[model samples]
Target: MRKPQQTPAQATTPYIDALLGYRTRGMVAFHTPGHKLGKGAPPIMREVFGAALLAVDVAMAGGVEDTRESTGLVRRAEDLAAAAWGGERCFFLVNGSTSGIHSLLLGLAGPGDGVILPRNAHKSVQAALIFSGAVPHYVEPTIDPLWGIPLNVPAERVAAAVAAHPESKAVFVVSPSSNGVCAALDAIAGVAHQGGLPLVVDQAWGPHLRFCSRLPLDAMSAGADAMVTSVHKLISGLTQSSAIVARGERLGLQRLESVVKMTQSTSPQALIYASIDAARAQMATQGEQLWSRAVDNAEWLRARLAPLEGVRVLSDEVLGQDGVADLDRTRVTVSAAGLGVTGYELETALRDDYGIAVEAADPLNVLLNVTYGDSHDDVALFAAAMTDLAARRRGARPLHGAALPANWPRFTRQVMTPRDAFFARSEAVPVEHTAGRVSAEMVAPYPPGIPIVAPGEEISDEIAAYLSEAAARAMHVHGPEDLTLKTLRVVS
Candidate 1:
């Protein structure tokens, strides 16, 4: 006798299916959205996004089902994502990776807890430090002398930090720096695991790494305890779409979910959730072909740019050095400083003259992100413009890479916890006189966006001077309320 056919639920896109079902129901509307779908929506919004998009905009409750606990569409979507990413569990984040970082830090570390992390962390990690009340044992990253960009900290450094601070609650590391430099994460993960600690890798720039073998190792396969990634950064997802995946019971899944719930919104955007689900499916199904083309374009650009006079394109040779175990070839970082121009200057000229918009830039290098959407024509135009600019070298001024002066303050004494300093009474004072005083805010140079001085850190004269000079040079200084850098926010 023939066996009965078993019904298998579609695994590719459960959230999207639920959303479509909710949208097609012709039920009378009485929901939180006063817009009542596109009927009550404004003309401009409807015309721009269209009625179809607006119609699917819904609340977590009621429309999908009468109660908060419905068909478990969101949970099923998360399961699909976990399966795709090779995580034991996964949680969808609508507020971006910032919230995921904050949630993980809060879940794993608490007051008086020490966490081993590199100092070149994103501003969000600093904020996580403040939010979680975790004390950080800072490790400096290896600097690339050519571009002056901070790469990953050596695994030995992480091991030393873990060994020195046995009381440390967790270890956090950022691989694949914004400039595409990847750290020795497998070794780092081993060190953390040997110490019986969880490794949290901020993989905001590596969502596509798993989809493409040509890319560097992803955090999940590297044995990270918890990994937070921004799907919108390198994958096909809307802005603010992110996900957190957990592999081990070290950071309890229940605890992570609780913290995530606290950090996320009750009225989360349905469209964002659907987009994440869809993006995951697309990557699982079609990412190999898409990223192969992207890598080809990046390789072509690298070859074309390397032969140009005074242009140094970053290559695989940087691997095998301390803190540099691998590289993401899709990111094209060209050193324009040697061409008698600042990365900022080259960026402006490219945009204004050739209509080519690059990604982040500093004094030394310009970063170009090659995505699957880019066409061959786009690459040709960029190459032609770069070659023309190289031929017309302005002057032979020796390149002064954007390395901070020896006196520049890279580290300041931490007198108080970030949480205390953030909540303490504070007053504004002259930036010059802020030396020896405790800071009440974060001050960072923009392009790289690493905080030079965060709350609870003492403000040194060297740091104040460096920041003041950076402002004068027109490098965008972010995080501080006083953009002019003439005043400093300090603990009263």
Candidate 2:
């Protein structure tokens, strides 16, 4: 894909320049952040964070611009970001994509409103349902038999869901899942618009998609009404940096901005804002070159690992299967099931033996994310580590009891709205006895963070047993009050 020509204005980082200017003025501190320009900071903090970083951690009010009046520096930066991402409006998020999801849900739907979304959505979407009292109409994503991972939701399923729930306020979906399987966004968006509903995408993992044509189509270009992307995920932004970009008239812009203000912090972190601003400029001017290199490195690693004994690296073979329209080359997903070891075992071996950590690992696959930040040397090191592990484990017997149960529940039966169950009086019950009861909490394996059982769902016996198995494997369970799964929170 040819790189888009960047305008001169895209090169300007207004908010970052303003923040740097403020840091250099040497103004006396009299407001919040008692650290007071690193003077009062402890020696340990100063040593680790350096003086320059500490000095620039200033408040938005009076530091970046006037508190009461609008200087439009931040607004101008957001304009560049929106244009770069093919959105009409963009709002920077300091609390990450989690907050962006919240704002999107709250802005679009109120209590009792129905939202059509995929069952494989991130846990943050479930949280949004709990916060907004929205009713979820789940569209189950196609499960890939080879990797035992959830793929994209088919457009037909979405259209069927929309038809079934005509009163639904909006439609939401996740594209380019954590493992890099992208949904057919254009077809899905067409169905969504034909149903007269706005398409909101949780594109937290595909922030760099718009910059590189080798990647899947971005949300805005696919005709989504609104979408959120985490700049920190696959880009040069600081941690917790994200942006909510929207286009088209289907969504109310004023309400969206109001909800963003409500969900975001009153005193947002200036550093995160500056990083978002600067990252946008970088991607706008140099993203094609940067992501192209990342894609090359990732493909090289995949090619090197594919020939190794008992190892399978996912590539173009996955395309045209399930609902996967395109693949992100920067994400190298490796399955070691043939090596007689689980992905968890492979991840641990790589980390402990080679001092190499991957982005995420499931029972069948380890997802390695290659970004502009990684060099060819970094990719080579990971490839070497994986090759060594595969060679040592060749001809070994398959690990018994390493796989999750085939009957492991993906989406449980929803008995009530998430908000109703979450806010209702609840009690703790033993995991074994909790089957057939209404769950008052959410439980999911971290990294992918898709809930196996969410609030208001009726806990089935199969789900209960799966939780026990997940716990036994020491999978980092997220969102449940009882991390051990010994007890589950259920509605009274």
Candidate 3:
């Protein structure tokens, strides 16, 4: 039987309504005491203004919500989120994906337990290891030399890991990576679940996936046990606003919420929650429409840019290679190899001249994110600007920078659990001398936001060389200090 067309409100999730209610009720809050919703926020802003929205900064009001114990508004919001995302339970994360990952690692898995993780994850994953005290098994990703960016880890690698380490309690992987490269989640999840482990997807870049099937499949639907998303990344939410979707009977909502409460802020931003609700409402009503528009806009943009000289545009072909299942087309990652400039040079010119900033600037490629709000005109303008750039360059282009190091490094074995290495007495060493020693920090190039080296992994000379090249390009790589990577901190 054909299903009835859903009304916007019917599509409106319950979490969306709760968010509306918070805004609708503007009554002065004196109950939580600290918030002073009508009064100034404490210490940080010794404000005396009653009208300041900053004062809306509130505490866990007894009657409204209790994020720590999560029995009030938080409970309802999470319930609705689960229904919206088709997960068994959903947890709100005011602290962002970092906290969600930390909580999942510490709560779902145990000390001495092993967790397999993608080498391309963020620093927060390293933080999770420190807190969880779990041993980590590393999985390397395929680097596309043409793009100079790391792709998602293959399913075969994951399956092999699961087979090798049956004791692994969980696996961490990301889809719709910052550059928009995606992986075969269903296949990875199949491996984890078959081995009696939970698969955790750091789907921070993929919040809009489920809203439109044309984009990519949502992590939950792909059988991941838990998926973390940052609403601020793709939607109109305040920073640090995030959510964790958990499916399957294997996970415990009570335990997960406890971990969140343990790590998250006590005085949660009602603003963050409201923003999440607002995004949810927008998605509920115009999900298919909004995402549909975004996808169409991206398609139009890529097609227009494809013919431009000196511009090599990357697409599903770059992503759909051996290990991946699907590609996210929203990210237009263009390499100026054919042109006479590095991505950095083009990015600087674009900002200075056109006043249009790309998503991220790197040595090789600059990513431009296309959303539902963009129009064909914007795409045409971008293409024209590139054409002008190519014409100016003529036949001249910057010499290709040092070729990326041929061989990358890998960790030998688990010398110590992350929690142990993090806390164990340690000392500083030069980057070159640090090889074979456990790493104390996450060092990675920016733009793509993928860490080439993370905490607890054995440091290597090759890794050091790759990082040095990135720094030479003035790339924003987040990690320990460069050169010697000196003053290294270890378990003390």
Question: In model 2, which range of ten residues has the least summed lDDT?
Answer: 399-408
Q: How does each model score on lDDT?
A: 0.82, 0.87, 0.72
Which candidate number has the best TM-score? 2
Error of 1 at 111 (Å): 1.0
TM-score of each candidate?
Answer: 0.93, 0.97, 0.87
* Candidate 1 stretches greater than 4 Å from native: 1-11, 66-68, 394-398, 401-409
Q: How close to the true structure is residue 113 of candidate 1, measured as C-alpha lDDT?
A: 95
lDDT of 2 by residue, 24-131 (tens): 898788876889888889999899999898888888885676431377777888889998888889999999999999999999998999999899999999899999
Tens digit of per-residue lDDT, candidate 1, span 22-114: 888765669867788778998999999899988877776856662225667788888888877768889899899989989999999998899
Clashing pairs in 2: none
**Residues 1-492, candidate 3, lDDT per residue (tens digit)?**
111122344344444445445546865665664555545455455544334454445555542445435556666666656666668787777888878888888887777888888877777777787777777787878777677777788999999888998888888898877888888998898888888888889998887777775777778878888899988888766899998888756677778878878988777777677677667666656777787888888888788778777788788686467566777788788877677667787788888888788888777678888877678788778887887777788787544654333234454455667677666677766554555667666665555555666666665667655655545544565666543344344323
Model 2 regions lying over 4 Å from their true place: 1-4, 67-69, 404-408
> In terms of TM-score, how similar is model 3 to the real structure?
0.87
The residue pairs in collision within model 1 are none
Of the pair 1 and 2, which is ahead by TM-score?
Answer: 2
Better candidate number, 1 or 2, judged by lDDT: 2
